[model samples]
Target: MILITGTAGFIGFHLSQRLLRDGEEVVGLDVINDYYDINVKYSRLAEAGIDKNEIEYGKLVQSTTQPGYRFIKLDLTDRESLNQLFEAEKFATVVNLAAQAGVRYSLINPQAYIDSNIIGFTNILEACRHHVVKHLAYASSSSVYGLNEKMPLSTGDNVDHPISLYAASKKSNELMAHTYSHLFGLATTGLRFFTVYGPWGRPDMALFLFTEAILKGEPIKVFNHGNMVRDFTYVDDIVEGIKRVIENPPKGNPEWTGESPDPSTSKAPYKVYNIGNNDPVTLMDFILAIEEELGQKAEKNMMDLQPGDVPATYADVQDLMDDLGYKPETHIRHGIRNFLDWYREYYGYVTDQGADAGAITDQKKQ
Candidate 1:
């Protein structure tokens, strides 16, 4: 059986849907916390045709129409339950996607990262070790490349300096996973994702926030005085990459040496790859995409960069492509349009081509 955490999340939801459509049996787990909107999470579950029977506290139960998907709302931090779940399920492959995911929010509640990302990941590693799971794939972040000014951020590059607590926690995860792989021979792969965005995405993310605010006639805050850049990746491509990588578990690098080691691979059944579009999008261009999708102009209140924020992020996807044949093709304009369509339908927002982005006037050029 294939087990997935954060199955209700954006990437997780899309992945579960894809796997179920392909007739794969999937067992999903999530804590269902009120971090953003529990209703949206539940709605995503319902859309998956999950039965709400046998519900537990803070948990949602789902049985799929595809007859191959099941979801259980459970916290990764609960070690006892996590172990029992792992023991009971006998999952051959485990995708660890659950984490308190936010860069800025990490500055406020740093403990959340420790509990979820660190402690919870530790439990997952131990469970894999004890249960004899063949492979484990977990979500790392491009944030791990913190404070690095390098262009086309490569997984092979050193990721020692991190600017945010979130980045530090992700880096810590890579270290922990390497140690586990070395000691227990568990096949592990860490993906450092850059600015993933698409339909049914997180509310806190830039695309979602920008689309919502612009549609509502509110000024979307353009950070770094409109100088930032991001390797904005589509969720669909990420899920596709993941499905392929899970089947091809990592083998220890024979050429790896302790003196001159590669950060991307280890002698111990461990690997890390950068999953991104590899095309950097300037902040101003991104704003223009939303403006075109909404068919409205945004009132621009250009501001200095925020703390724990990087000026730009560009991913080096050569290793990913050469290894897994992964290619991300969704252009930002198309992705933005898809998201806006979903937003209007899902949220009952009025659809109008004349609708304008709030207060901040733009140097409107798409």
Candidate 2:
């Protein structure tokens, strides 16, 4: 069985469903912390057939809907419990996605980031080491490329100047994974995810926040005076890439040399890849897509760029395509439309005309 951490989270929930559909037995794990809205997290779990009322800390509950899936309420920092679960389950593959996940919030509570991202990740590594997992994949982030002005950021880029504590924590994860790979010969891969958005996305994300404010007729904050760009990848595409990576574990690069080392690969069984759309959409265009989907204009609250924010991010996904034969292709408009549809249905939202907003036809849908 595969062990997926942070299963109550956005990407993890979608990934769990996909894996279950593909006939993979999955054991989902999450602490169900109240970072954003616990309601959303619970709803995600409910969709996965894990009733919120049935969950108990440190207990495993089988899924009611998907027969191949089970869930456990656990935190990564609790090493003893995590180790016990790993020892009992003997998961062949592990994916670490549970982390205190906000760039801005990291500044407010740096300790939270260290606890979940650092201490927690250490516990995961130790558990995997003792459990003899074949492959381990963990979520890295585009924010790690702090202060990097290079367009189409590649995995080989030097990411030493991380600006936020959150980014620094992710960078630290890559390093820690490499150490385990080199020492214990644990196969590990780090995925640097770009701006991911789609149905059931985090409410703190740009798409969700923009949709919420516009639907409520409130002014939406446009940071950097709307001069920003993101390689906003769809959640489905991100999960697809992850699934591919999980199936194909990396081998040590024989070509790797110590004198001139490649940052993306190592002589050890470790690697990193940037998973993104490879298409940078300007912030204004992204907002326009949301507005078009909602058929409503947003009252823009022009604001200076907040701290721990990047002006632009474009991913060079050539390595991903060359190695995994996959790339994120979802357009912003299509993604926004999908998210808006989910938001409206989940929240019982209606247009000013007392009708549901019409769905936009996605000609690019494949």
lDDT of each: 0.85, 0.92
* Candidate 1 residue runs with Cα over 4 Å from true position: 52-54, 57-64, 351-366
lDDT of 1 by residue, 1-366 (tens): 888899878888988888878778898888877778776777777778865455574343557566777788788888888888888889999988888899899989999999999999999999999999999999999999889997989998999999999999999999999999999999999988889988888998988888878877788888889999999998888998888889889999999998998999988999998889988999999999888878889888888988888998999989888988887878988888888878776765544533453211221110
Going through the candidates in the order shown, the clash numbers are 8, 0
Off by over 4 Å in 2: 352-366
Q: TM-score for candidate 2, please give it.
A: 0.96
Cα lDDT of model 2 by residue, 1-366, tens digit: 999999999999999999999999999999989889878888899889987788999999988889999999998989999999999999999999899998999889899999999999999999999999999999999999999998989898899999899999999999999999999999999999999899989989999899889888999999999999999999999999999999999999999998988899999999999999999999999999888888889999999988998999999999999999998898877888888888877776656624333322121110
Most accurate candidate by TM-score: 2
Instruction: Give candidates' CA RMSD values in order.
Output: 5.1, 4.5
